[model samples]
Target: MSSIRARLLAALLAGMTVVTLLGTYAIYVNARDAVDELFDYQLRQLALSLRDQAVHHSFAPPAETVAEDFDFVIQVWNPDGVRVYFSQPHRTLPGLAQLGYASITTPDAEWRVFATRLGESIIQVAQPMRVRNAMALNAATRVLVPAFVLLPVLSLLIWLIVGKGLSPLKKLARAVSRRGAQALDPLPVARVPEEVLPVVCALNDLLARLDAALTAQRAFVADAAHELRTPIAALQLQVQLIERAGCEEERAAATTDLKAGVRRASRAVQQLLILARQGSDAESPTLQDFDLGELARSVITGHSVLAAEKAIDLGYTGHEGEVLHLRADAAALQVLLENLVGNAIRYTQRGGRVDVAATRRPAGNIVLEVSDNGPGIPPAERERVFDRFYRGTTAEEPGSGLGLAIVRAIAERHRAKLELDDSEMGGLRVRLTFPMPEHPPASP
Candidate 1:
């Protein structure tokens, strides 16, 4: 669970350290070679000076003096090949031939030698290899020490720079941490990086969904409480009356009230259950092809009792030529039709007309219409008619106000359109228009 900055810094430091080490090694080798060249130049120049002194000035030093004065061993051989002057008289150090640069070794130690002719003799200057190597090692150390100190400083600077570069991320994390659980406002994206724009956009979308869900939950609770309390209170009052009954007659009266209360409570409970089912999940099974006209006819037949009681004529009146094939949940379609027809029957006056019709329009739409010769909805209030618990202008009817809302919900589920318009019989019209199937079978 290492942080990104930590990981990046670790990698950066590792790379820098490796590169610094390699560069340091290269610098060290260069320094060593530079020191070696200096030593060789000094050796060559000393041999030339000694040669000039012997040939021109004849300033020869005694063997003991020469050994003490000179920092290195020296050898002089006469033209006849006899050793004339030699430092380190006991043991002669290894010597090189004339002309080019060379090095020689002896049983005791190794030496870098330079030989030149001095008139009648050869003067050879040989310095011990130990002195030259010590100088090179010192030079290499001088180059390595500064590099070691500078690498750590450079790595620290890089780490700080990386931290500064990632400061925006730290701010974002802090901003998110400080938000309340119920807060669903969009994240502050003004200063966010383009690299993180997609994440911010996704978070904003999630917040919007969460806000919608919370609003729905609140509305549901309020609506349930408001709807359930009425029936529950009615039931309570009815039970109290039954408890206070003085005789059979009084008890009979209480029993009637009790029955009405029970019915109301039962209806409220049913509406609640329907609302619950109508929740976000479209648990309705896959839509099956069904006859809209036949379904409308069946609903009209079922509600004939209401029409009869109200003295209204309930009948279907549209083209009965072909089956009204539509893709929708059959049971839901039946419920929708039943509600529309029943409501029409209940609202119509005695001897009024209630007509159910299903027809396929030329534009390839199936329209299901239920109308009555009763008071129609006002233009201003038609929109609210689809809200749950929204009793319309005709509130005297026994309804949970959920019928039209359920109709709307089902219509949406089927991707159909429901409109309220003037009926042909001059009353309210509830029409559900569904899209025709892509391919329709011709009438037999």
Candidate 2:
């Protein structure tokens, strides 16, 4: 059962054997019937042939004999019930006189008898039943003898045919087994049968997906290592500067710079961990109906103090009472909004206006945007801002460059669209458009 070849071969042979047995039995039965008819005809002809002989009182016994000591017996009984002629002298077929064909049982065997009444004699002719049975068995044997030799040959042919039909699967398995663990390439499907093509296609899809995931993981690891190295080395140098300072003034100054460096390195490590976690499980399904307007307001409030420190105007301008809804993982959506609004606050200059808005437009799309009237990314560099560790030409602030990349990942998770364009407020507009909610928002 563990081997497909053994399983199929056993099933085929078992079914064929059953059919062959039933067929042979049918053939033997039909042939026996035909043989019986042939012998019966011979009996009738022999009886007819002896009719032209003279009517006699005594008969010379037949010179030849068979198993019953006679092949056939002839008797003529006159009208007075006296036996006039008998073909076998010693053996007799015992029965009351029957005018037509009848079975007459004797001491040695049964006989097939045909009796008829002529003008002055009762003509009786009989043959042994054993002889009829022997001829029938011989005929049935002749018809069935070839099948006995043919059964083994037919079984061999069936086995070869089944193996030929399954050879492609064997080749496919061997090809797969030859692959190294690092090889994540798709399997070949062109030479496979139509029945197996779907399985191969599914396996290829799995391999392609696994390969993409592994490649992304490697890239993330390398980029994170490179990004963390700079700040960590700076922190180490700052720590040495603090420890080796010659006076209190110099030591105090070094301590402040070292703490600042620690903050920067800590912030960078935090951002990298966030990016890695999000990338590791990009599409974890935790969907629920939530108000996007409420979420936008919450995110903007968290960054209000940061905006205040820069003397930048930060506020939410969404509709007061209406809910803009969506079904998605709330944690991912929160991260996305924080990145957008935090970047807007961090890069904007003093007195620059930054406004966060969640709106349901006339086209049934829910749009969330953070607009800042500050120096923004140039049109030529807008697309590259989403790449990890990429900074625009105009960027002068100390920051990790994973903000927009994380935003893009979250947008993709929600099937939302992210776009950057020149704001009507005379700076950059970072907009994320989500499709209409799948279900109505909860009553608040």
Candidate 3:
């Protein structure tokens, strides 16, 4: 894995080295120019000084006597170009040339020569190019050597600074790792850098949501346990009654009651399962474009036998044979409709009417309503009806009290608006308004 500190250190060190090399090259070039100018000036001054000095035709110094470090090679010649005098018996002395400065290349080395007139004779002062080059190299080495020596120190400093800058991220990782599974508390946000603040805030928000979901799950489990206790106990009691019956008639009656108790227990268990499945953190619904009116008719038909037994007039009263299209989770919407229609059938008085309808409003919203001519919920208790395990004060029927709660949960998932109101039929009307899609699918 590539570490941020390592990458930063390498990049910084590489950049510093490149800059150092460039700086050294610039210093070498400038030093070379300065040395060349100084040496050229010295050559001109030497040639001018020789103009007044005495010159001997055979005054050349012995080759062995010349110092190894000696750089200048002075020479003189007559107007006829015959060599007259030379300061040193150098192997590569430049020949006499026209007055002023010039450069000449010999087999051994290149020379910078300054020639001037000394009365009838001509004097020439020359120096090798290698001498000036050595001076420039020494000047550049003074700068380059220090930079190379300090490179390790610069690399160390860069590594420490990069690590220090990343300390906040390290702290955050440690804090997250130390948390327990049940520790859903928000992470600290204080002293967080501006660049990392958004990440911390988002994590805090996620923790808050998880805490709420876990709390609701715990409550749901507890409530389900409490609600199931009564029916299960009743089933046991009814079985005991059947076992104790003395006559054939008494045993038959006891068996019938036991069956009823079993049915009630089964119904309660089913409702509890439905409630759990519709909880906030339950699996997402499968949404599709389906006919809402058809779903309503189907739900009413399923509850028709029960409605008929009680003499309740259960029927669909929406537009005949017209499709009331809606975009929603079809299965969840079916469950919502079943709960509404079943509750209406169970609670309406004998010979009363329970109507289920689905219609599209002019403003492009789908409205689903299940209304019944039964004793309506009081206005004060309407809001509380949607709470889990809550029943109306005047309720006389056996129920798990989760029907309306399930309906409300499904409505919330679909982002639909649910309302409880007095129906025109003189009873409760549960209406749900679902917003239409901006661009609806094409009909077949």
Candidate 4:
């Protein structure tokens, strides 16, 4: 029953059986009616033929002759309603009645009798109902026997036709099963039936997306390995220097350099990890509503000590007490804010100012900006600054060039638009615009 072929066969065969039975019943009823009309006509004709003759009581036909002629009984009666002459002697017979054609039931059998009078002498022709019924049954059988005999042949034909109709699906399954794991090519569409074309096209689309994802993953791994090589070699050289220190002061100095090298190498590895996580296609961001301004202030607070160490002034300067609510992945947004603020603090000159702000525009779009009074990126290198391991010409800081790349990746995940421009403070400004829902959730 689970198989389509079996289900179809069962349903079709059941339907055919029901139709055949109904047809046979209809044929039997029609045949029986026709036989009754024909026998009744014959009864009337025989009675009429005898009406003109002298059915003499002295010259009665033999019982065997009457039985063999037409399985009928004949009788001649006088006007007095007395038993006159009967061709066949039986256990019961129809009593004389006044009628042209009538049906009478005797103790032995049901009889169809026809009577006609010829000048006060009556002739009756009678036949049993069972004879008519047998004729009807025989006619029905003759008409329906061919259909009954062909039933099994028709069932076999249905099975073969159903199998032929489903052969395309079987071929498709075999073709798909024969492929290797790495074979992401689309299935061929030529000669595909219209009914199955949609499934084929959707599968092809899925295969194409899988291929693209794998290619991107391979390139990311290769780029990450290539970018990590320089920092690792630098750390090794620093370790060697620390091992070959000559005196106490020299050993202390070498140790300090080694510590800085270790910090740089650790920062690079951390950045690579963040970039990899942001670029992953498998992990989807958790979207929720949060106060964007509060998040901006929290990031600035975390980077406050660094800003102070560089003698840079960093603060939030958006609408003072108004809440700027945004719906996005809160964790990813936090990382984006941290990278932007850290970069601004690191690259800004001493005594320079860096400001962070989050604001909601009249159009319900949320905008975030981080600006600094540092040597900004030139217009030509601004676009390339977001590429992994790409440093600007004006960059004088000794650090990995992954901050903006990480920020861009996070922004893209949140469907935000990021742009770099000259700040009003005579430095670089990074702005991100996030689209808002028409009916945003209320603050809790």
Candidate 5:
């Protein structure tokens, strides 16, 4: 039952056996019925022939050898019930015959008798029931014998046909089993059966995705190694400088630079972690409606100390009230704003003006901008600045070069567009455009 071939063969054989038995029994029953009708008809004819002969003569014709064996028995009885003529003499059959045809049974056997009245006598013909039944069974067996013989051959043919039909499935399984660990290439679907085509296609899609993921993972590891090497080497050199310094002032200067290098390396690693997390599985972003102006104000306030340390004026503009809001990831957008503002403050000269602004466009889109009067990136290096660890020629400040890269990653995660332009404050302006949600709810 566990094997499909066995189950199919068993079911087929059992059905064939049952049908054969039923048909054979039907044939036998029909044959026996036909035999009964034929023999009864013979008995009637014999009785009439005897009556005609008795009318023409006084006795029956000579009995044949078949009449003496399993043939019909004939008798003539007078009106007074005295035996007159006998074809095969029998004592157990009644001395008298009943009118018409009837079955007469005695202790010895059962007989089918047909009788008719002649001019002055009655002629009767009778045959045994057992003999008629045997004749019918013999006829049925002769016809059904060949069919029973072919049953086994036909069953084997069915088993072979079913096994051949399933060969393609076995081939597919073998092909999959022989693949190696690095074989993330898609499986072929061209020769696959239509019934299994969907399964093969889904597997191919999964393999393609897996291959792309492994490639990205390898690149990430290599990039991380290369980026970490510089800060670690700088830390080691700073440590050596501190160890070799003889005066207290020299030791303090080296220690300060060492701590700064440590801070920069830690910041780079943190940004790398953020970029990796944002690049993965970006289908359903955690989105909710929040005020863009409020977030801008908070970011500017957080950078105020840094702005003051350089004597720069950091302020917000164009955001009178909460008209600009978007459905986006709050934490990711917050990180994006922090990176933009922090980078602007870091690169700007002392006393330079930095402006953070939020404005709603005529098309109902929200635009957020962080602009500064710092020596901004050249037009040639503007696009490259977004690349991971790609610093500009004008960038002389101490930075890990991951700030804009992190900003770009977070902006992409929120489905926002980032563009670089010249600021009115005579520096770079990083503009982010957030599209208005279709079918947005009424503003509160």
Candidate 6:
């Protein structure tokens, strides 16, 4: 069969054939019962008729001609149960009781017998059971032959019907096969059956997400290429200038420029590395309890030279109680703090102020703020400052614009929130807040 409908139809027809055979057997049994009743009644009446003939004649009569018509035997027995006459002289049929009708077996075969009593003797009439059984077999065969012939034809018709029932599923398969690889449009769900609608809707949602990811990746690549080209070109020019300098002083000046270019390029490369390690579902960083105050102090100490060189004040001003134990990736926290402090030190002029502080709030929350007296980011450009290669409106410093972006990436990885507000130094305030771990040391 070409379809499921056809297969089902064939199966149904085969089942019907089996049922029909059973029905024919039942009908045959009913017919055999009816015929046996009529035959037995005829034998009973024949015995009574022969008895009357003998009584009227008052003689031990010669053998009767009843056997010529009925193809059976007739016998008579005296009242003392002595056999007087036999229809088949080769084998004697046994006389039965004077009751209605009975059956008996001879040496050769079985017989159906009828018996009745006369004045002084009993008469019996019987027929062989083999003849009756043969007749029943012939009749049953005649009735069942037609059903056997029609079974195959009905099976074929059933197969065709089942094939038609599965047509819709085949059509859906073909429609899906014709689509191209990048075709993300949703399949039409309106005409589909209820069982299949959910599958189509899910595919459509997947396609929509794929389209958005592709667009974002394109924008990221373009921005990265644009950002990397500037430093690379500057490094190349600085190297060439160092080579072509005419005097020792000129060569020394070119070497300094070359070193500066190398530093910028190294920073750009480090930013890219941080971005690569920043987002992964599988590689969550190890977290531990760390003192926020200690971390802030350490970051400030690392940047002491920068602050001293610029003549700016850089130090910590927060609670002395170590009540601010935080759960975070320590490495990421260090990177985050270093970037914020570095940015603050870079932007502030000589004699400017930069403060690092970690303060504990009321409800297991620790607030860490790094503020500077440099020109602050304007309100309109603060949001874009976290974007890759996005520089703030008041940013006139010479550096890659990825420091805040790296800070945001690290914060997101740790599920912490970083906010920007107006600093007490009349400049920018970059605050990083995280929940304090429960069951920590009260104070140390």
Residue lDDT tens for model 5, 1-444: 298777888998899888888888899999999999999989888888776563323344454633446567777878777777766554467547568889889786788999898877788788888898899999889767877898889888989987776676788778779998789988888878886788788878988888887887788778788989999999999999999999999999999999999998999899888878776544556888888899888888888998899999999987577567678888888888899998888889998998999998889888999999999888889899988778888889877677888888778776689999899978999999987787675657
- Clash count for candidate 6 is 7
Q: When superposed on Cα atoms, how far off is each prediction in RMSD?
A: 10.5, 6.9, 6.0, 5.8, 9.3, 10.1
Question: Which stretch of 10 consecutive residues in model 6 shows the poorest summed lDDT?
Answer: 54-63
lDDT of 4 by residue, 258-315 (tens): 8888888789889888988898474888888888999999999999999999899999
Which segments of model 3 are wrong by more than 4 Å?
1-155
- Angstrom error at residue 426, model 6: 0.2
lDDT of 6 by residue, 1-444 (tens): 364565567568767877888877886787677667878878877887886574332223345743454567777778777777676666655555556677678887788888778778787777887767666666777878887787777767666655555555677678768878667676777777665567667867877777665665677678778999998898889889988999999999999998988888898888877875674322787888788799889899999999999999999988766656777788888988999999999999889999999998888678889999898888788899998888876788987888998888888887678899889878999988775565665555
| Full-model lDDT for every candidate | 0.78, 0.81, 0.89, 0.87, 0.83, 0.78
Clashes of 4: 0
- For all predicted structures, in order, the TM-scores are 0.58, 0.67, 0.70, 0.70, 0.61, 0.56
Worst 10 residues of 3 by lDDT: 89-98
Q: Pick the lDDT winner.
A: 3
Candidate 1 root-mean-square deviation in Å:
10.5
- What alpha-carbon RMSD in Å does predicted model 3 have with respect to the real structure? 6.0
| Poorest lDDT segment (10 consecutive residues) of candidate 1 | 54-63
Pairs in clash, predicted candidate 4: none
By summed lDDT, the worst window of 10 consecutive residues in model 4 runs over: 58-67
lDDT, candidate 3, at 159:
90
The segments of candidate 5 whose C-alpha lies over 4 angstroms from its true place after superposition are 1-181, 194-199, 281-284, 438-442
Better of 2 and 3 by lDDT: 3
